[model samples]
Target: MDYVFTVRRVSKGAFKDEPGSTYFLKVPEDADDISPDQKVGAAGAGMPDKWAKEVLAAARSGENPRTVQPKGDILIYVHGFNTPTTTMLKRHRLIRAGLEREGFEGVVVSFDWPSASSALNYLEDRSDAKQTARLLVDAGISAFAARQTPDCEINLHILAHSMGAYVVREAFDDADDRPAVASTSWSVSQILFVSGDVSASSMSDGNPKSSSLYRHCVRLTNYSNPFDAALSLSNIKRVGVSPRVGRIGLPVNRPDKAVNVDTGAYYERNEDRFRDIPNASHTWYFFDQNFYTDVFQTLRGDVDRNRISTRAGTRSELELHVA
Candidate 1:
């Protein structure tokens, strides 16, 4: 089976002469051969011409035309609250571009969930985006598993930031309940939640027997900061408790269930600065170069490279900086 890959550019803010965001698609790679425009624009295909043109243009310019085979391990990224489709694309491209700059190999996918520009909309979408995220994960996993070759070991990793972590958690949970999906021969190596806002109670609610999270993925890591302003506000407005990763009252010893990366040091250093709205404290995990270097090391499975000592009892800090 052949797969088609394309890269789409979207505008998160105003649609101007130059678009602000870009995202790549990892289809069969052979998808380049068939013009989505032709298929979608044909009288019977039923898709709008505008949509077809956009997709065709994206597919044609997404990657290096000369590059033949798919790149390294596959990584799927889901962005968090208040993110527009264009911002999601641009952020993914930035991450991919950075990884390539660091000499990493792999196909990076951005799972764009609909986010409205308004704060209220973002909040509502954050609550409702899990279903869409599940679909994205299922589609990506099924597509990759179906096409994987025996000689090549394909590793799937999910990296979700902030509210995006909620989507990942929900998707993983949902996948676990479906035996046909959960029992697949393919495995998800790791799930990295950066500044996740999910509550510990939500994670611990059901009996271990019925929990899909522990059953489905090999590892789950939560990176958190007690000082994350958005998360703090979210806690007050929504869940009543500070988000899971940075909750101050949790036990000093690591929970037997999930891997937690204490980000007290990072938070302590940048707390005052991240309190503002536009600053988006959580995003620093991806945008800052030094921060991203630590994230890269963690993704490469070199947790020690970027270790930080924290009062939270010497927890691994790299886990908090997912790309």
Candidate 2:
């Protein structure tokens, strides 16, 4: 079973965009059981308080006692825009499988915000993303951080994709505005962005737009792909918005802890294999073994950034080397 923390409203046996109470659900991995129209109600869900504790316990315990690093990690996955309930569930399963194949022993939890399945609801989705951003803090990250005692063996991390990056940025900024949340020692280890939809300039050093995100995470690794057509479309759709960090890479004045990995070359080399796939360049990282290998190493955080085997170049600017 996989964990799903959803904020989408249930209506007529389906998940809708309207706001609703959040649920902490333990869903099965069976593809036959999970469908876009299925009503995931009280039967599969746990009490909010109980599930939060369960997540923390899993994070603190090692999956394998024999491993040198006995401590565990928790990766909170915030998915991209235009993802339906079924797609979100499938991707959650895929992430766990992919990471396991690469020998990752950590737990993967998904934060499912209400994103419309239609391709034309970009503006609507962005608005919802901003509206729901705070829940990611209040119900997800902050809840975990508040419960974690000092010297805890677990590591908390976030892996956000596409417009999910915008949600993360807004969430951190909103959290900083609240005195209650700001006073807490809530922080994460690694903040990874895959095909992030936020602007490059906003992530630069000294930028007020993302200062809170920079302050909270130990490291920020952005996986950029110049060939991401979806982000290019996002740029165009936003009416001449600044270039996205996922497509144009980080700014020259990026934060000290921020690192950029240009995956364009590797994606370009393997583009043909994904020719028939939808949003291939933008979403291909989920299907790539090398990408998982790099992510596993990153989540481990034991190897030096410059020493990660699947990468080349300096810490500031690196190229993903296909294995």
Candidate 3:
């Protein structure tokens, strides 16, 4: 069963009133164009508190030994920009099914932000994504942290794709900027950044943007590929850009905190990746089942980073080439 709790970020007027489908959104091309999306019966359709509460409850339930409990981890997935609202729901179910097929016992919670879904609206989407960061941290992470009693041992894992990495990073930034709302003690067990679209230096040494994030997460894994076309465009499209973490890899300086898994070798070995415009390499995490197996091992956090695969590149930058 798909155990997904949806949080609609777009305003009510921006969403179509669908009976069966709960989420339907209009693309936000201009900041002033669309109304803010919210709850079912909210004034002007304010955002719902139920889904966030539901996610917290699910995570809490996973820790209950007295009640029916799950044997594995709890995942909170945040998708990148330009993703349509309806497609996001499908992706949630797809992820749950895929994880189960790959021997992972877990439930997934998807945090849906209002993305314009238009490649041309990159600026608009970026603005919207950054602002949504606080919502994820406050409503999702903070609330979850508050619910934990002295004996709660639920494992929390995070998976972010593409621009979703931006969201995660910005959330930490938001926490640092606004400490009153930030839950400093909410330590994430593991985080996987799949083809992240953030600046490569953001997570490096002395970069305060990542200080809170790295401090909060026990382990962070960056699934990178040099052949990611989407991030290549991201570098050129954005002003004052550095090499992206997803395209190149994380800085070697923070090896203890973040491990860069270079999946580029897999792409070079598999020539059939060019069937799509963006290339199959970018989406391999979802398309390949073995990747999920690797992810399962990653969640364990006990395997040595070097022992997992052959290490490539210099000591300043390490890349794991896993089959």
lDDT of candidates 1 onward, in order: 0.53, 0.82, 0.66
* Cα lDDT, model 2, residue 48: 62
Question: Per-residue lDDT of 111-152 in model 1, one digit per residue for the tens?
Answer: 655555555565567555754555544555554555555444
Clashes in model 1: which pairs? 3-27, 3-28, 3-29, 4-27, 4-28, 4-29, 4-31, 22-89, 72-105, 72-106
Expressed as tens digits, the lDDT of each residue in 202-225 for candidate 3 is 888668888878878888889899
TM-score of each: 0.67, 0.91, 0.78
Best by lDDT: 2
Candidate 1: 10-residue stretch with minimal lDDT: 1-10
When summed lDDT is taken over every stretch of 10 residues in candidate 2, the lowest stretch is: 32-41
Q: Select the stronger candidate by TM-score from 1 and 2.
A: 2
lDDT at position 103, candidate 2: 80
Indicate whether candidate 1 or candidate 3 has the larger lDDT. Answer: 3
